[model samples]
Target: MKKWKAVLTALLATGMLTGCLGNGGGSTLNSESSRIYVTEEGTFQTATVESYVQQDYYNGDELKTFLEEAVSQYNGANGQNQVTLDSCTLDNGTAKMMFHYASPDALIGFTTQYEDKENQVESIAVDKLSEVYGQSESEGVTFIKADGKKADQKAVSKRGESQTVVVTSANPVTIQTQGRILFVSDNVVIKDSHTVQTTKGKSYIIFK
Candidate 1:
């Protein structure tokens, strides 16, 4: 009713959505916490699983409705279904909301509209990683494997047609990709070969 972001802040402030934060992420089959799934084509889906507590003054159903309406409004104004709320459900005080975006740009626009400026996916590029990030690849641009091992410098130098994702986020969430992650930024936590979690500030992932 009062726009989605404001309402969510109010709900959290009122303790209607109260619970411990999550450390892991989820996939299409199971979403343990909140995670973003990215494909080779750059389209992605997000599973937002947050804890909540039932209270007489706060209605979970109403919150779901508000979320749906917010997504719908954003899509409608964009003149296409660039963003869609795949599902929203509350069970045992845990709320899971799934959103599918046509592209990374769609997600950027949606987040911008909600005033969530801290989380930004600025660019998904196929150019040289150093050029995209405006740094010298020769200047010890540290790139580590998903296992936190130093990636093969030879392999990095020989990169060809690789997809690079440049993201800046203060929130903690795991990002999953279908391709083998060649390297990730310093602030990223190694989740697995195919996934990495953001710690803070700027982070990048290069995948085949």
Candidate 2:
């Protein structure tokens, strides 16, 4: 009787451990599956898998073809929406491409398809706005404006998106729309009165 009880207890413990591990694995998988979207004004947005198609590029030829097609489609769709491939260069093994467009919206739509894994977790300074889409990091990214400079900026990440944006000064910062839980650290201030204050220095904001 004693031996049977001990065996039963051991089995129950093993089952509980397995259950906990399974739950942990599922949570991590869900987090990794989240996607980040960059807006026309160079802000990050996050969404679930159901929102957008996942982008993939196997090789250089594939990327080039995609870009060419995007430009062609944009030009054909609207007479005023013209996109030009300003420059293309290969540095070491990485390729750098510059595009010129008449409209910011058109430029964003054309480049959205290529905003995939390649641009994950990439950081860019606000001074170099041209390079924003190319180097966006998946887990998180930061944008900094030079100290004492005024900034009118916005970032839109998908709902439930987790990332970090570090501003050099909180004076010029503003939160327009929010589906994100922002944890502000030292020297950051919330200029928006509507933002809900969670702690002394922390706040939370949610958009539809």
Query: Residues 2-23, candidate 1, lDDT per residue (tens digit)?
Result: 4544656665445454223344
Q: Count clashing residue pairs in model 1.
A: 0
- Candidate 1 residue pairs that clash: none
| lDDT top scorer | 1
lDDT of 2 by residue, 84-135 (tens): 6543332233333445555434434543433322212222111122233223
Residue 85, candidate 1: C-alpha displacement in angstroms: 1.0
Lowest summed lDDT over 10 consecutive residues: which window, candidate 1? 20-29
Candidate 2: worst 10 consecutive residues by lDDT? 19-28
Give stretches of model 1 more than 4 Å off. Answer: 1-9, 12-30, 56-64, 115-140, 170-173
